[model samples]
Target chain A: MMNPISRVAKSLVLLFMFFTLHATAQKITPYLQTTSQVLELPSRVLNETRTIYIHYPKADSTNPNKTYPVLYLMDGESHFEMLSQYTDYLSRWDVNVIPQMIIVGIVNTKRTRDLTPTESIINYFGQPDTSRVSWMKPSGGNERFLQFIREELKPYVDSHYKTQPYNILAGHSFGGLASVYCLLTHPEMFQAYIAVSPSFWWDREYILKLADQKLKKGGSLNKTLFFSDASEGVSDSSTFHTNLLKFDAMLKAKTVIGLRFEYNYYPKETHMTEPMPAFYDALRFIYKAPYK
Target chain B: MMNPISRVAKSLVLLFMFFTLHATAQKITPYLQTTSQVLELPSRVLNETRTIYIHYPKADSTNPNKTYPVLYLMDGESHFEMLSQYTDYLSRWDVNVIPQMIIVGIVNTKRTRDLTPTESIINYFGQPDTSRVSWMKPSGGNERFLQFIREELKPYVDSHYKTQPYNILAGHSFGGLASVYCLLTHPEMFQAYIAVSPSFWWDREYILKLADQKLKKGGSLNKTLFFSDASEGVSDSSTFHTNLLKFDAMLKAKTVIGLRFEYNYYPKETHMTEPMPAFYDALRFIYKAPYK
Candidate 1:
């Protein structure tokens, strides 16, 4: 029912459409996918089955024999994913500076109990809140918490996976306090430590005094340490920055051998927001020199 | 055949050994397993089939409807894993600012051809290389390359997966030049554009000239742009810093509306090393003011 010229035009349009469809059918290749699992751990100290989160790089045909370093993070429930992603990207085979590492996020059952080093009735503002809902009621159980890690957790991870002995202990706030605590008490447990906005005023700077006592004059302590503080507002006319400064000075005076350390102050960043840039800087500083 | 006391002591040692083995076994847990896959893409424009590496987060049993934003990265074979890990970590439900985004890495087929705009014989030294092994032999195929993305690649991605319209385009070096090229030619293609150490030295700074021409005076251009440069040594009495400064001036003079722009220069970082920190800074700058 159509003329030759009209039919010719129609066929040309159909041909163009067909080629377009074929071109559009080309598929895009994805670069990365991740999976997260909830791991249950029985903590004899807490007398409860605590759920810890573990994030690791997935294995592919191209990299089946790859083994990863481990970063045991505190406050795992809060910032586990942040550290997981940071390690994954920084150590990517292509990015390749820091080695691909496994992230073992230790979720907190009772933050006050596990992160604090000593029992104290004082709060952040030096005021005692003896209320039933007091956040500091169950404080000072870090020694037992560290025991949970040394006795129960580390063995579990080592036996279950292909892990390198190089380990890093990292945390923020109370978790940050715990990171420094672990470094001071159990230095041999980890190769590196990261403490972001550590609660240095805990039990009137208990960890500060401990560091002074444990780090003997002219003694050798070979380890890497990264600590940072953000703009934490003053409560009771006492600034958090002052405490951090004092702690920084204490560590500097010790001058422990092979102690690769960096202290960063983020004025524009808040306590909660400091992790974004702090973690990135930490990784860069930790792996500044290439791993041979 | 031994004496009673000696036999009893041997039996006690064996019992102790059995308890130790049983205790160690109780402490260790099984390793968590994950999987990965590789994807391939064939392009007629470059006459090559490129391999794209992929890593997907393992699906969580608790949350299944978590759709991710897609980051279409240039120079996939170079920095794909870095970006992948950054996004994954920053978007973990705890440290969420930007949503968890899927990374679509476009591996280069013809590096020089697809990334450049004009077919020129100009080398980095501002002289023509007329030799057979010239790196710029088949230069200037960005138009067709972008066509492949618009008609062929994007459609394929949209059809194959769950993608939000909010997309980001990122690149470094020559790939950085391509990022700006796409921004000028196809303004609406991506929500954000990241160019780390863009080669403004390309084609006598053709992209800079094009930016001046296309960006109309007092016009609204709603886009987030993060560009940066690193120290590339002072050569021929000229430094890489001067080039970046010029580009920064051009953007400031235009003063395009709704265009959020941040420029960073790393004096200590090298061209190859800048991407690590620059990319991290860019992400922070892009998401500085989070959506409530």
Candidate 2:
């Protein structure tokens, strides 16, 4: 092995060479840079500023006027980078499985407040936690959150980015429940919806009841939906998996025209581990076609 | 829809509020940033400069002295960001499927010259392409390339990064063939190997013959290997998938002690799209364990 001193000298020489070469030759940036921008959007409805993580596709000079569909994802801090990376790779020139998408990751300040649709003291278990410092203390601001996205966030994104009219809304857990709620309540907002392990046990299945009431039989629901549940129900005593099955059954019962949907069950994966594979499957489902 | 002028005004107001809040409150950078560095290393073995993409996991203040396993991926330009993103997400606090790894993506300077093991004029078809400017003109320099990795590249990485002794070698197509060659020739270099849709039809299945000759029956070959093939053989009328099956059968017959291996075949996936799912499966296989 080379000694530490020589290594240091070598590094110095390499650095000098790099600078000189950079000055003379093309800049030595990576072949492609995944530019992730952090933006703070002022939410008029929620009365607070929301942080958004926007990941744009690499610029195509040949097709400068090309626009892309947007994937607006909830829980940005947790899964934004993953989706961004996935979108970039799957939509690459070599691997043209999916469309190139602009990923808008909505970072969360108040998870329960924004994700939950109702203010309830009930926890994951069938017990009530009425403590002031409970994690679920501030719940049920999802409607306002939706209003923020519709009235403020959507308008901002539309004006700023070269976006096609098609959009997708994706979420997991409570965020997943919020996605289902959005699909039932505001289906026109997005062309497709992905809900990975949605918490259907929220408020004793409030969303399920709403879905039952809202979705008319033989209704013209022209949209695509991808939802999933993992090993949560099998491990925990809760009926998380059962709830998803019920939702699937409800959909099968209703004859909504133009409603394309796929429900997946991953018994081997946990709620957290499910998203990696689940999200990939969802993309494949949404963009299923013959290889070009 | 909001008018352009009003949207521009809204953006200005948001930008002003962002700067003001940024100054007063805590800086709004995300909690975790998957930083990727582009490195240019002058190589003496190959007599050429090489570009390397290194992606480090988010630093942990709780464990400042944490060292990570390194995953050295071939074809860095194609899949560096994807692997970086996968590593970040799978090793997250909530997901926790795999250990956090330092990804060293070896970008290609000359694709065919470095990735192929043998100097041959045999093309993908059963015929020879002897044209002067054929893509296969610069046939093989893989041994010299391996020397660069073993002597120059590995030393540089070990000295520069905080790395554990454990390493993984991953690749696809020609890169995948290179990975298998490394595993067969230099098994001690990496603890694990992932070959996604390997181009096993290279040079009239030279690697297969080598495997048969070199790998003694019931030899003590200790390593973790994951290899797969998609629908390439069926489409191209080539023996890519058949070659993998033969290799698998050879391994099974050999009964190499301490050789942990898994073979996956994705009939639905093309050679290009196979890596996305196959890599994920390979990770799961290598890191298979009960949830902590």
Highest-scoring model, DockQ: 2
TM-score of each: 0.76, 0.90
Q: In order, what DockQ does each candidate have? A: 0.14, 0.28
Per-residue lDDT of A75-172 in model 2, one digit per residue for the tens?
A: 99888877887888889888898988999999999999999899988878767888889988799888889988999888888888899999999999
Candidate 1 reference-contact recovery: 0.15
- Predicted candidate 1 versus true structure: per-residue lDDT over A99-174, tens digit per residue: 7778898877788998899988777766676787777878999988998888878887887667888888889999
Clashes of each: 12, 0
Enumerate the chain B TM-scores of all models: 0.84, 0.89
How far residue B269's Cα lies from its native spot in candidate 1, in Å, is: 2.9
